[model samples]
Target chain A: MALFSSLTPVFIAIICVLIGVILKKTNGEKEKRETKSKPLSRPWVDEDLKDGTDHHLEEEDVDEEWQGLDENVAHVPFFAERYSEGEMIKRSQMFYELLNKRRSVRFLSDEPVPREVIDNVIRTAGTSPSGAHTEPWTFVVVQDPYLKHKIREIVEEEEEINYKKRMGDRWVNDLKRLRTNWIKEYLDTAPYLILIFKQVYGWLPNGKKKTHYYNEISVSIACGILLAALQNAGLYTVTSTPLNCGPQLRVLLQRPANEKLLLLLPVGYPKKEATVPALTRKPLEDIMVVM
Target chain B: MALFSSLTPVFIAIICVLIGVILKKTNGEKEKRETKSKPLSRPWVDEDLKDGTDHHLEEEDVDEEWQGLDENVAHVPFFAERYSEGEMIKRSQMFYELLNKRRSVRFLSDEPVPREVIDNVIRTAGTSPSGAHTEPWTFVVVQDPYLKHKIREIVEEEEEINYKKRMGDRWVNDLKRLRTNWIKEYLDTAPYLILIFKQVYGWLPNGKKKTHYYNEISVSIACGILLAALQNAGLYTVTSTPLNCGPQLRVLLQRPANEKLLLLLPVGYPKKEATVPALTRKPLEDIMVVM
Candidate 1:
């Protein structure tokens, strides 16, 4: 018994050392996980911004079968309205001139835009292509002054944190030339605040979650079309991705859990004194490779 | 010395267990990193794709100062063209009608399109707004039949693997209704195959890597504008992300390592017998909510 008690001290010391090593390893693992989830390079990106695979991973225990169309749908013949080459050239050049005039105007006028125009442009965005025709987008058009202010508060609050704390010196320095800070007066001044939400997943008729593949890319493409529509209609807005404000905005708008905010555009006419950074686009040769 | 010898066996046993635990933890860490890098739910997404953070991680030892515009650029007064309310409504409706007519046409005609139109449409795409004014996009207009055919071969080979093996039964079954298969004859049939690449990062004048934030979303938006320009000029094309063909096509087209293929568009006239699935967009009310 005396010998065993003598050995207990050494055994306890070894156990203590082993436990310490294990504790350090576990702490390292947790730090690694945190870093993995929040990439250091792009700290401004919201944690909620993902490609819906996270949701899919959670629901993996449920239905493994894809609940898309049960049977093949019929295809109808498509006849395009073909324009003459000369006409095509003219139209293309004219369209380019019109769109080339587009600038991301941060200062918006409170002038009431035609609600019909906003409706038409949102409708135009709805026509964008999706992965397997899964149209996973929701357009929340907030015109109520109270809701607009609420959104502005949420955006400015998060953006202040982004600029001051989350976004490091490099990102802040990168945007120094653009003169963009957390102040978004346009959010309150614009006639409409069009907040776009990408539906990560949709419910099947049987109450199962159906994965919407490429939802972010799909919705962004649709937003592209929406931008064109807005420009074509002579509307002005800035395409802003509010950092870290997605979940709050999603909840503020009462959007379902499956929906995440992708973009927020305050649509209206530019304030008469609106100014944009004198930025030049890369020439066609610089941007295009003809091979 | 006699007592130490007696305890040696127990010490060795404890050491063995400690070593085993360490090995298991390390293995677990490696497995976790692998899973994090390649999310299982969206396995078909190319592994190369990332928001420029991977490159940033690699270059951590380099200069950390952002090499964007050193001096703040001047802001210029912006004046948008104002259209009458009636004109605005009419324009918005007309634009929607034109864009709504667009369908993803897989079957393309080999008829030569006006290269000027292609240039202008791309120019319009170039005018897209990007993060921090970093126009990170390359539109490779491939008209050469040989190169086009080479692209077709690469796409088809990858697509065959994707459809046959890479994509499991659920994905394949999901796409069964769309009638899409590994066969992509449009790669050869289209007069021009516009491969859009997002420049993930760019080299500064001082040879340091400049991060291009939101490059994927920016390029996709440019593509949206490109699609709109094509439609306005009565051109027909389909928006396709040829799965798993990004790296090969990038090398095939001689693009730089910093660029990754985002979308592949076959632009030309549609085949006479081009048929589209009778898909209807969600109505404005279904897609939009007013608050």
Candidate 2:
């Protein structure tokens, strides 16, 4: 009777955690659950992994299938039909409300945002699709005033050189309109800065193997999703690649050898009054050519 | 009067031809009038080719006052209100209508789509944002049965090795859920295969140089936009990057050295009967975080 009582408490605790986590993730799709027909025809569990009912792999790297086909033959492959060609798009209500309203702020309010916001935004970015599912990324949130200054100083040093020496007359001439400089004020002004990094191929978690595939696409997908999530959260962001601070900043941050910094985004509210360049977009007709 | 009439015909004919050529190059954003903030701000005009402007360079390379910024920098450093962040993020009627309905399709039909659709789609893809607006990309529409056969032959070769030999038990175990293999039938089954290439940089018409930034990011953004556009047009596509075909396909296509084949997407209709593996996305809590 005592053992049963103890077991009951543990099971209930696990259920509570699961519920909390589920609540955290569930969003616009809740209403569409019933409408979802299984989109695939292939068996969810491979014959090798199925142990009568459960679906996860029972063990790692157990490659028993020696199924081979002639490389030259263009055989018809299987495609499951859980999702139809026309109905896979799910416009998220939460994201739509948020991303549709997001504004890029050049001038920022110096007010510090709740740390919770920064952490959550980074967490959302971490869920992006990566090459070979490598999940090759790192997020460094800078809240320290001193570190912000240091980053700014290093970035400015490079910008000055670019403007003064490295950048050619043609390139500098093009940049003349927006009046951008190497000294990024947003780096210092915004309460938080999230630096995104893409890890090239790296060792597996077991530290025994190499992996391959397109990581750039995977990282960009994550970035796209991140942009949508941040906008939904009632914040402003600018995804800017800091060209000048590459080598120096990486050393300053002490990143791993395999990682390359992709973008340094400044996140916060716009200044009480801010102005963006009035840029025009190409017309839809110009972009779209329907047959 | 006769002299005037003769000049008018000649002038009008040249202007018409010029516009026809320009129109072909103008991706999507041509509908918006070029914002005329200043004559100096236009991207097309050669800044150095001054026609009695306030400052003409006599000693360009030696001039210390000239900011080290490249001459190209003057080409509208930022595309002014070309798009407001809000406008850029808003769901366009076409984009919304299409993106809201997008589904990834592994199923493909052998029925050939008209070359017109392929032409229009590739033209649209050209408008995608590129690194430094270099537009460093090439699309090889492969409908040639002979070449498609060659591509499938090579891709399967590596994939066969990956699935059976090189892939570890852990890697194999993780891949079981996706239910994919070295077997690729879509290459032949789809009516048209769109091969995307990333050109690192390009030469100007004058043989001067240009540089591209974040080429992969730029290319992927274009790909996302292209995918969204293609899906919106009621066409189906699946993005596949078979890096194994990088050398052979490039040689086959005669792409320049800098260009890398990144994605080989087969575009057409999903087969009446198609099957995909049973896969469920991670719950919202697992994928999204709230601050």
Candidate 3:
């Protein structure tokens, strides 16, 4: 009994040491999580990470089927239209004049646009070049009034949250100047609501994932062509990226998991009362540096 | 001396406990750092962060000069050209057919292109919409042979490293199929190289940074318009994004720190022997979902 008492202090010290170790471990994990959860302060580092072209490293291996075809695909002769310098200058000027007239019209007319024009515009968009020719865009055209209203609901709900909470005062102020708010009346008023989706990854025939490299950039480029096509057809749309509403809109549109909403365009003619902000583009000298 | 001997075991035990606590603290810090350094495994989280539209939260407040304009800009009546339905369909179809012929031609001829055409196309691109109408694109046209060669050198060096080290086997294989390698002969051979940079943020009059929201996507959309204008003017270019070479190229070009290279296009006529991958685009039904 005397020996037991003597050893008690040593035993107690051992238990104390173990308790300290356990507490340290728990605190370490908690601190680690806190560090990660904190918004990254280094913008440059985050910007580098968001390069968007590093999907090859981010994804698993795709199937050999399509890739093998890439190896064997024949290279065909490409012949482009050749025009004289005068003709080239004239065509470019005319095209520029045509495109310059395009404005993001918010007050859309409910007049029905020919469906053929929408299809043709989308087809033109599909011709856009992609990373390694991986066409990773899907255009969802909603003409039904009910579905458009539902989309408006999803978009407005999220946008309201964005305006009320997520968006700062400057952003709200900027939007206010643009005459834009969370309430998007054009969603229902436009004849068609084109929701563009970028497939981040594709599922292979074997159920494996195929990474779409530079998909966002590629899809945005396609949208640019789509805008041009719409202009050519005398159509107008206000390009919108509904913040924090991608997942809900994707599910509402019945799109698959790999698809992500990139841009939403309400396509139609502008109402007679439609007005746009009197904006001027920067002169060529301001935007271009010739070396 | 007798009392000191009796307390020796207890003192040793107390020292051991102190050592344990110190060791645990050190280990905890090391583990916390390790957790922070690990590549984030959650993609959806990363994807959310990559939403280019979230710059308002990411940047500091800008001086209120231009933003003030956004608030008070006059809403003028926007009059658009209204075409008959048949003419609209025809125009849209014609535009599609024209864009459909556009291919990513790798073998570009050294034929000099009209500078006026390039200017007009850039003007057209400037007309494209942006987030809060902040035109965040810089089109750097390199006509000097020496500078183009320097750009090519920088691109090739980084590309070689990417091919060998950063890119995995599958990516290498994918590019192999596309017949693209680190040796970018077109950079030197093409008459002009248009390097597109997205000004991540603009400098306000007060020297504070003005955040360009959705800069990457907006610049890309402008690029789309640029591509359309190029096609209209009978110019050919292969859109290329030189990975890991943006910083070096930016330094060589003497662009400001705010500008980051988004895409580099080698612009000219296609080589008579220019061949593109014999690829077919998915049909309209495949790409478009109509509701």
Candidate 4:
């Protein structure tokens, strides 16, 4: 009890210090000019930060009844204005509903999904944030019979090797429920294959290979978005990272040396006789803690 | 046209070849005694190699039957006999809806989020799939006042330094849209601060650190699940890396050195008057391509 009481003051001091520190880091850079006053008022009070007028969300609030205010962030455009209150709620809710229906489709139907819809869904994925905003990802849509065949050939070859030599007995044992094997009929059966690539670093306009910030994290987030958007757009997706096709896929796609193959997707409708593994989700109590 | 027509047969042959190879590998290890076919008559012929069992998810059936004939998968315990149609639709739809609302929130409200809620969410995050099933993340929940303050201070100091010195002009300029400065008040205003540590590897059952499989990717996916769950539970969150609090956080928390700070999250209810930056999503056409 005594030890705990003594540590109380130190703890309080730490919390105050942290709060001050974060405000300084997140706000200080924005108000470099005002060293004398609190940075908070400078941006929040400035009419410009309330989303000064440039956006395409179809909202009608940009007409200025007032005059000139300083643009606090010269580089950053005003937070995308033009989104209305009702629209925001609607869009947010709609997105949630759409995302709810997504599934990993292992069994696929031969029914064709429209290319335009797929393209639109992908467009949504591309909007995700990336390291340095490099947006370093390539979406390859494979529909050609020969190309998919080659991909299947490559993937199956590697999988067979992994099952036999690379993976241990324990791993093979662990995979007993996944129902996966080298024969990926979906690779050919699906109407489309979206191969994703991640670029570690990127080429600049001046021919320099600029370093990317948090490349792996950025790519992972974007990949998640891509998967989600496909589901939202009424498509089934399974994220597959084949063990040994890194070299073969790179060469086959004629991709740049800096880019690496991350996943192979067979996107389409589920077969009439499709079924998913009867997996039970952990109850909210097991998964969540409410304070 | 003639070249394309001739290639179709070649493609079909290639798929067959892949199938042959995969079957060869799978059967190579199957025990001879187990290779005998079942004599019982069934409607489903099941032409393909049965890599795993299917507890059929029939829409007509309300309860999913567990036959208990299959192998085990982490976080999946059902050896289901049959899945109901409603179950499949519910699962698929749930995935879709949850996925769409998923967003990385940087802007946050200071209103306190319950510790129990955060804990529950972290537990849920733990349910995600890990590479080789080696769970490689540690969750450190810090609610102590002084510790929170200290974290804020250190984070701000590093961020300020990053903006002024390390980050180039272009990089800083690019971040302009975010209007992010070093000040992170949400760290304090929020009720709970959850620090996620990525364990590179940990001691095995025998006291040796075991090798982790694609540990980074696995942990990230878990984070994704946690984020989804938190949102579903009606809580707001802000994900941050802050600046240089990584080492300090580990020290402050007295964690094993193998763990490195991955993300610092401030969870709570959105402030009553709080507003998120208005951002626009890219149109659907820009992202997807179906060949």
Candidate 5:
């Protein structure tokens, strides 16, 4: 009789466990269906996953990607001198005025500029922020007359076709007021042409391809800074994007196939009689919206 | 006999002119054939098209594109106080040093920031250069908790799939050192989220679509400037790009189809116990090549 009583209790315990498992699985499936239907719900909250406390900071053994690279980092004490609000406003205004005075110049003088100036300007450009610090850019300084002559020839050939046939009527009409033609004398006359090439991918020492993220955006930021640097040095430049520059220039410059030409900037002094079309930028109010 | 002699001279002159025209046409055809074969040769040059002389500046009646727009331009007297070369160098160095100290912060505090500060920072971003001065960008500031919660949930949902399935092994391997996972609590915790939307095309008042040029590059430059402005104001922000953020965020923010989401920045003060991955930027020589 005692043995039978014990057997009965064991059977009841097994049934209770089975019932709990079935209930838990049914709840899980229901929650999944709800999540699929309404994605913007607070269904996926795990209190343990939150890094809200100071405990995460105490974990010094965390494996970060940089830790695997074993790259050396230099620490330097930084102390930025605080400026009065008035001084800050004054400096901001000054920078705005300086940038506003910048204009695209077509009439260039063949006056020679020091190589050191170009070097400094490029260094300033290098300071631009990039995605993941993958600075995928190379600035090639072309000053040789022969190379410039060759580039000009190719650019003009393409531009001639662009103006005559490739460009639609509306495009041509829009450019009429700018008075730009296929013949680019400035390309030949400028003292320097900074050819910015963007590296789409990189090769490791073992020949594995390294993918670059935001290469176009990163290079464009550098180009903007380059313009500012050149202007600050009392030099003028025009942002030229010659169609079909990638294939021809790559061959001429002996650059690898991985790099693509981004910008061709003809940099030099403006001719004494240099004139730009009387153009005005949209007012600040039109461009900016306050919400 | 005198009349016959005069007519004969006139006939001789006409014959000489015809022969000259024929010879010029033959030479032009030959040059075109040569250009087709050897495009690097300088086959195009028009002395009249060159703007080297100062005479073009004297013409006031030249029709400019802006002349047709009839937009009122405010001509503010701009007289930037010139700094000595030494002072200029000092200022540039200081600015560079300040920027170098900026690091991407992940842990954010929900400390309330003044609206005026955000306004100034956005104004600074508006000053960035754009393609043809089109200024094709819109910055939408979101401070509503409900909207942030929705964005966070969507981002985390996609990120979870990305970490588990969508992203390849190599990409996940790369992200390991960063110690990041699908959980992004900063989106909800940060006081303000600046959603930068890039205008792919604009709708005119009459509902006609206006094409934008270099829209991607222009918006990227503005984003860089925005980051700098935020840093300059002693605020912290992370350049967060939640994958598949376009369609969902567009619906949540009520943005138009023509505008695409470029960046989603979470801005606020860093948490007291915030810690970042120990990473180092590539040195100048690694990033820049002067040729």
Candidate 6:
């Protein structure tokens, strides 16, 4: 009789757990259906609201002025061409392969490239999105032999100081595998040296200055695109930042004081025997978190 | 006779100018032919080199140790499939057009997004190139409702203070056209809030710090890729940087002190009636220089 009573309680417990599992699965399906039913909803819209209340009007007075401001601005109709899912995957994979081949080459050839090619690459880079559309960047192309030689000398001088003094022992040690030194023959050897300058603020016609927001972040994004464009053109380049050469470079390039040197790119073909250190990228699991 | 002599000198000068023009045209053609004949030259090989000296050996002493260093490190063979030039252009153009369609939306839908979609987009973002391939970035995905609500409240508090006190009058005026306010409902409404934290330095197994290079520039590139990836996935997102929310967010998220907040992205579908500001990008000529 005791064994029957205990067994009866265990059977009841199992039945309750099964019922709970079934209910949970049903709720999950219901939630998914609800999500699909309304992929996009605007509760703030007056026509969609069940209650006869316009919530937008309840905002502050400053926000009311914003609507008037929007009216003053002009907008053009825009429609993007949609691609099939398969097409998107193909394009993404192709781009990934293209970018994968890009490497920073130190040994650059002196082979002359057409000026039009450089112009097109820079234009492609300018297509990068910027903060508030400020486009606070300037791409200066240097091909003059004298100017290239001068830049090379100045960069070497600064880099020598950096290698010996500015950079800590550990920092220098980390760069050992890169096999780089104070000597930068590529600066003069490369046919083109594109100097990217970040504009801190804009100069108005009235001689007043307008502030640029997220200038550093915006310029960095543009530089990344610039590197990609150069590589896409089958050109090899290195992102070289010669410490303390900014002041001298500004004077040599005759740029305004408002412009700061952001990055220096020596673009050309890679030498036949050019080599890079073997480095492995972190696996995707180490860099991402999924919830 | 004197007038005839003067006319003869002028005619000779005009003839010389014509000859110079003809010579320049011929030189341009010859240069183009030369470039085409040897598009990619392997001069480092012995056949092409006039001198037997290999310039690679002349580098600094530390560089000699690099080949030894390569032996210690592991390498995986990488070969990306090549594409024709015409196909490359087509793909680049398609990508450019797709990215052009991406707009920063203020009104976001609260629609539920598939977890797998977010995972794929983040993985795409991780493929960005970093300085020395350090890949010093961490992506934090925030989806919990309570946590989202808390982030929204804190971001709003900081933005309100910024609009009133921190931002100068000129900066505020510039933002008037966008019709943005202190309120940030999208932070809570969006299904995912991706917080990108930059690792300034890494902690080794031995409890030593390993310095990261170009951390700011590296993170910015990753953020750009993240934006492109999200847009590619048919999702709308805005890069939101609400200053002064870093400290509180770190505490809430429980991230280490070394990780600095670089960018905050709220990803979701745009509201059905969502509208964006009409802003034009700078013309190509204004941002690029050719010499």
Task: Find the candidate with the highest TM-score and give its number.
Answer: 1
Docking class of 5: incorrect
lDDT of 5 by residue, A187-224 (tens): 89998988887776555455455544456667777787
Stretches of candidate 4 off by over 4 Å are A1-105, A168-170, A230-235, A269-291, B1-107, B113-144, B160-181, B199-211, B224-238, B242-244, B254-258, B268-290
Q: Candidate 2: which stretches are off by over 4 Å?
A: A1-128, A141-147, A161-178, A201-213, A224-238, A244-258, A268-291, B1-105, B109-130, B139-179, B224-238, B251-258, B267-291
The stretch of ten residues in a row with the least summed lDDT in candidate 4 chain A is A47-56
Write the residue-wise lDDT of candidate 4 on B32-139 in tens digits.
312222201110112111101111111112122222224654332221122243443444455444444434455555545445455556655665545444566776
Q: List the residue pairs that clash in candidate 5.
A: A64-B177, A65-B177, A65-B178
Writing each residue's lDDT as its tens digit, candidate 1 over B6-47 gives 676567657756775776677679657645644555655665
Looking at model 1 chain B, which ten-residue stretch has the lowest summed lDDT? Answer: B52-61
* Candidate 3 local Cα displacement, residue A221, angstroms: 0.7
lDDT of 4 by residue, A1-291 (tens): 656545544555555455545544544454343232322211111111111111111112222111121224233211212234344344444444454344455776677766556555455456555543456667778888788888889989988887776654444554556666668888888888888766654555555554445545555556655565455445676667777687688789787666666667788877766665555444444333222
lDDT of 4: 0.54
State the weakest 10-residue window (summed lDDT) of model 5 chain A.
Answer: A42-51
Q: What is the TM-score of chain A alone in each candidate?
A: 0.92, 0.63, 0.83, 0.67, 0.74, 0.74
State which docking tier applies to candidate 4. incorrect
Candidate number achieving the greatest DockQ relative to the actual structure? 1
lDDT of 1 by residue, A82-191 (tens): 88999999999999999999999999999999999999999999989888788999999999999999999999998998899887777789898888999999889999
lDDT of 3 by residue, B19-130 (tens): 8778777876776555443222221122222323234334533443344434678889999999999999999999999999898888998988889988998899998888
Cα misplacement distance, residue B226 of candidate 5 (Å): 3.0
The per-prediction i-RMS, to one decimal, reads: 2.9, 29.6, 5.0, 27.1, 27.7, 32.2
TM-scores vs. true structure, each candidate: 0.93, 0.53, 0.86, 0.58, 0.66, 0.69
CA-RMSD of model 1: 2.9
Candidate models: Cα lDDT each: 0.85, 0.52, 0.81, 0.54, 0.62, 0.64
Off by over 4 Å in 6: A1-71, A75-94, A111-117, A231-233, B1-95, B111-117, B231-234
* lDDT of model 2, residue B10: 52
**lDDT score at residue A210, model 5, on the 0-100 scale:** 50
